[model samples]
Target: MTLILFTQIFVGLALVFTVAAFGWRLRLFNALARPVDRSTPKGNPRLGILYAFTLGMAPWAKESTRRHGIAYLRGVAFHLGIFLVLGILILSPWLYLLPVTWRTLLALGAALGALLGLAGFIARFAEHNLKALSTPDDYTAVLVVSLFQASAGLWLVYAPALPLFYIVSAIMLVYAPFSKIRHCIYYAYSRLFFGKFVGSRAVLPHSQQGAR
Candidate 1:
C-alpha cells in the first residue's frame, strides 16, 4: 500500500479504537451508583447547570482560574484549536478544494495552539507545584498532543506533510482515552454534578448576588 493509504488506514483504526474506548468509559461511568439528594433545593438546578457550563468556566469565576488567568486562557485556546483541527482532519480529503484564505487562517490557529501546548508542557516542568504533581504520563501526553498540533499546522501549509500529520493524529487519538486527555469526556458530567450540588445549597449565584 502507498504511504497515504497506510496513514489513512491507521487513522481510521485509531478513530474506531478511540470511539470504542470512550463508549466503554461512558458505560463504566453510568454503572457507578449515583446517590440522589433528597434535600429541598434553595436555588434553580437548571440555572446552576447553565452557570456551570457558562459563567463558571470564566477565568474570574473560580479562584484557580482567576489566579492563573493567562494559563487558563491558554488552555481554552488550545482546546479550541484542537476542536478546529479535528474538524479539519475530518475534511482533509477535500482540503484541496477549500479556499486558500480559509486554509491559511486554520493553519495559523493550529500553530498558535501548538505553541500553547508547548507552553503547557514547559510549565509542567518549570512550575513548582505543577512539577510536583505531574506524572510521566502527563509529560508524554502533552508532548504527543503538542507534536500532533504542530504536525497538523505543518500539513495545512504543506501537502507533503499529510502523512506525518495523520501518523501523529493516530497516535494521539489512540492514547487519549487511557491518558489525562480523557478528562475532557468527563468535564460535562463533573460540571453537572457540581452545579446540582451548589444549586441545591444556593452556594453558587448566591442569593445576595442574585438580589443585586
Candidate 2:
C-alpha cells in the first residue's frame, strides 16, 4: 500500500479506537450511582441544565470566565477550530469541489485556531501560577493538540500534505483518552451536573428562557 493509504488506515483505526474508548468511558460514567438530592428543589433542574449548556459558557456566566474573558475566548476559538478540522476530515473526499475562496477562508480559520492553541501552550509555561498548576500531561496534551491543528491547517491549504495531518491526527486521537484531552468529553457532563445542582439549590441563578 502507498504511504497515504497506510496513514489513512492508521488514522481510521485510531479514530475507531478513540470513539470506543470514549464510549466505554461514557458507559462507566453512566453506570456510576448518581447522588440523589433529597432536598426539595427550589428551582428547575431542567432550566439549570439548559443554562449549563448555553449561557454558562458566556463570559458573564461564570466568575472565572468573566475574569479571564480573553483567555476563555481563545479556548473557544481553539475548540471551534478543532470542530472545523473534524468537519474537514469528514468531508475530505469532496474538498476539491469546494471553491478556492471558501477553502482559503477555512484554512485561515484553522491556522488562527492553531495559533491560539499554541499561545495557550506558551502561556502554560510563561504564567507563573498557571505553570505551577500544570502537569506534564497538561503540557503534552496542549502541544500535541496545537500540532494537530497546525497539521490540519496545512493539509487544508495543500492536499498533498494530508499524510502528515492524518499521522498527527492519529497520534492525538490515540492519546486523547489517556491524557487530559479526555476532559473534553467530561466537560459537558460536569457542566450539566453543576447546573442541575446549583439551579435546584437556588445557589446560582439559572438562565431561564425569559432571562437568557
Candidate 3:
C-alpha cells in the first residue's frame, strides 16, 4: 500500500478516537445533576435561548466585543476556516476532481485562517493583558491549530501534500478533546443555562416573547 494511503487510514482512526472521547465527555456532562431554579418563572426560556445563539452573539451586544471587535472577528474567521478545512478533509478523495478555481479559493481561505491563528498566537505571547491571561495550554493549542490550518492550505494547493495534511489533522483532532479546546463542547450548555436564567427572571428583552 502507498504511504499516502496509510496516512489516510491513520487520519480516519484519529477522527474516530477524537469523536469517541468527545462523546464520552458529553455523556458525563449530561449525567451530572443540573441545578433547578426555585424562583417563579416570569419569561419564556426559549426566547432567552434564541437570544443567546443569535442577537446575544452580535458584536454590538457586548461591551467587550465592541472594544475588541477586530480580535473577535479574527477569531470568528479562524473558526470558520477550521470548519471549512474539516469539510475539505472529508472531500479529500474527490478534491482533485474540482476546478482549479475552486481549489484556489479553498487554499486561500485556509491560508487566511492560518495567518489569523498565527496572529492570535503572537498576540497572546506579546500583548500584556493577553499574555497574563494565557496558560501553556493556550499556546500549545493555538500553535497546533495554526500548523494544522497551514498544512490544510498547502494540501489544497498541492495534491501530493494530502498525507502531510492528514497527519497534522490527526494530531490536532486527537488532542482536541483533552486540551482546553474541549470548551467548544460546553458552549451549548452555557447557552442553555443563560436561557434558563434570563427566561426565568423576565429580565432583559426576553420578556417580549412571554413566559414559557
Candidate 4:
C-alpha cells in the first residue's frame, strides 16, 4: 500500500475508536444517578446554563480566569485551533481545491495554536504549582497535541507533510480517551453540574442573590 493510503487507514481507525470511546463514556456517565434538587430554586437553571456556556466563560467571569487571563486566552486559542485543524482534516482530500488565501489562513491559525500548546507545555514545568500538580500523562498529552498541531500547520503549507500530520493526528486521537485530554469530553458535564449547583443557590447572577 502507498504511504498516503496507510495514513488514511490509520486516521480512519483512530476516528472510529474515538467515537466508540466517547460513546462508552457517555453510557457510563448516563448510568450514574443524577441528583435531584429538592430545594426551591432561587434562580432560573436555564439562565444559569445559558450563562455557563456563554458570558460565564469570559475571562472576567471567574476570579481564576481573570487572574490568569493570558493563560486562559491561550487555552481558548489552542482549542479553537484544534477545532479548525479537525475541519481541515475532514476536507484534506480536497484541500488542493481550496483557495490559497483560505489555506494560508488555516495554516496560520494552526501554527499559532501549536505555539500556544508549546507555551502551555512549558508552563506546566515552569510554574511551581502546575509542575507539582502535573502528571506524566499531562506532559505527554500536551506534547503530542502540540506536535500534531505543528504537523497540521506544516501540512497546510506543504502537501508533502500530509503523512506526518496524519500519523500525529492518529496518535493524538487514539490517546485522547485514555489521557488528560478526555476532560474535553466531560467539560460540558462539569459546567452543567456547576451551573445547577450555583443556580439553585442564586449565586451565579448577583442580581438573583437578593432573591434568595
The candidate, 2 or 3, that scores higher on TM-score is 3
Clashing residue pairs in candidate 1 (N, C-alpha, C atoms within 3 angstroms): none
Candidate 4 deviant stretches above 4 angstroms: 208-212
Q: TM-scores of the models, in the given order?
A: 0.95, 0.93, 0.95, 0.95
* Tens digit per residue, CA lDDT, model 4, 65-85: 999989999999999988888
Each prediction's RMSD to truth: 1.7, 2.7, 2.0, 1.4
Model 1 earns a TM-score of 0.95
> What is the lDDT for 54 in model 4?
83
Model 1, 1-212: lDDT tens digits are 99988999899899999999999999999999988898877778877887888898889998999899899999999889888888878888899898888888889999998999999999998999999999999999988988888988899899899999999999999999999989988998999999878776677866774453
Which ranges in model 3 have alpha carbons more than 4 Å from their true place? 206-212
Give lDDT for model 3. Answer: 0.88
In model 1, how large is the Cα lDDT of residue 94? 90
Candidate 2 versus truth, CA RMSD in Å, comes to 2.7
Error of 4 at 178 (Å): 0.4
